[model samples]
Target: MGNVILRYINLMVVTLLILSFFSFSLAYLFPGHPIENLTGIRLENISQIENTEFNYSSGESLLVQYWHYMGSLFDGNWGVSFNSGLPLYDEITNVLPASIELSAYALFISIFVGIPLGFLAAMKHHKLTDYSLLSISVLGYSIPVFWLALLVILIFSLQLGWFPLSGRISLYYEIPDITGFIMLDIFLSDIDNKEAAINNVIRHSILPTFSIALVTTTLIIRITRRSVIETMNTEFIHAAYARGLSGRQVLVQHGIRNALMPIFPLLAMQFTTLLTNAMIVETIFSWPGIGNWLIQAIYHQDYPAIRAGMLAVSALVVIFTMSIDLTIRLMDPKRRRLKRAAI
Candidate 1:
């Protein structure tokens, strides 16, 4: 077990370094002197990342320059944006919670709603219910996220007037920044009206959330339908039925438990994809998030912010996926046996 965990940690470190290097290398894709041109800030400003100045002396190789760049980026010594001239890290951290809050809500909706819909479809196999869901999933799989987001905005935000078109919350709700997450902040605030503030957050969230959730939910539905069907056919499920267990008990107690295990890693991987879609969704809706910040950095060609954003987002996804792998290993009975064998 310890060895498995150690190996996973070691791999995560290697992946993070590789990802950081890849982000660092993006500077070299263009003209000369990558660091000086890309950072846009004085070298001395970035030097305190390690409290050691990096001249990137003429004699030094590209690798050495990368080391200094990586150190600065990883440690938040990314200096400032070329356009806004704000510390790159502070800017990113400020908007990160918005992205996280949106992503969390999207994922939560997909999992809770998708799993049940999937099982319902599976149980109704060959019926209209199953075909309808499968058809919807197929459509979801095909539609581009950006287009779908736009369409939803057109309908919900514009035509029907059910939700706001953009922004995290209405300008009027001066929610305190207690947790950085607007919904929570609204609750933490001593505002004149808490419900209205939260209502604004939810209203703004609905369209974007629906856009993100549609694709993920469709995927979950497909996977869960397959997994649950396979679980239902297994001999153990038959034995449970023979032992007089109800359909609900068999599914809720035994079927779902085994069926869900295989999908845990898949869910983690999907989360990375979710973040990727979030970048586009954030930009489309003008939602304040790391994605929107990154998009602005790209538009203005703020290389420091771009580099920092890439590294930050890559690290976030890699770390999350690796952590999920470790958790899955810890929980899996088959993996436990493998660990014992290795021991």
Candidate 2:
């Protein structure tokens, strides 16, 4: 166990370093200096822009600029946004929490609901339950995210009047910003009237969360169902059945455990998918998250912000993939032995 963990840690560190280097290189690959593109005021006087005292330069050697850029990255100085003229870190930090919150909610919904439905579908096989679940899964998977989000808004917000159409809360309410997550903020705030905050947060979150969760849940269900079916047909499962174990006992004890071994890796891959979905959902709901911020940054051609956003997302993808690989190794001891031998 210790060796496995150590190996994963090493892999994670190496992957992060490689990704960071790639991000830096990609940022520099874009035509023209990011600063020049951002400022719009080119420095005709090379000497003035190159002054060591002011630390403002356009004529510095490429090597020097590269080193300075790398150094700034280490110091968390991602430069100013050309479009907003605001510090990149400030913009990222402000929007990231909202994205995280949306992702967390969607993830929770996916796991809790998707896994169970999948398990049931697998147990039922070609029965009515299975066919019904498969049909719903097909619909959930096929629906386009933007269209689904709009349909949800129409039904729940416009037609039914059950939820808010957009934004995190009612404009009239004085919401105390604690964690930037509307739900958490409501819980943390010492507002005299708790009802208003609770109601407002729930009303705002339902549509977006449901939209994002529907797609992810469908995916998880499919993965879970496939894994469970495969596991149920294995030799070990047949042996358990032959040993006079009840169907329920055999499934719960032997089947689900083995099924989860494969399902875990698929779950890890879902992290990246969830993040991507969160971005789309955030935009639809006008939720304040990193995804929506990234869309805006791209539109305005804010290179610094774009670089930061892409780096963050790519880093997340790498981490999640590595994590899934490590999890598979941990769950399947044979894989770990093979990995160790290969190493």
RMSD of each: 3.9, 2.9
Q: Would you give me the overall lDDT of model 2?
A: 0.80
Ten residues in sequence with the least summed lDDT for candidate 2 = 50-59
lDDT of each: 0.82, 0.80
lDDT minimum window of 10 residues, candidate 1: 49-58
Candidate 1 colliding pairs:
none
Best-matching candidate per TM-score = 1
Model 2: per-residue Cα lDDT over 1-343, one tens digit each: 7898887798788877777677666555776764455344465676645553145333477566656766877788887877788888777777887887877888898999999999999999999999999999999999988899999998888999988889877888887766676777767888887797788777788788888889889989989999999999999999999999999999889988789887877777787878898899888889888889999988887777778888777776787678777777877976677656553
Candidate 2 stretches greater than 4 Å from native: 38-40, 52-66, 320-335, 340-343
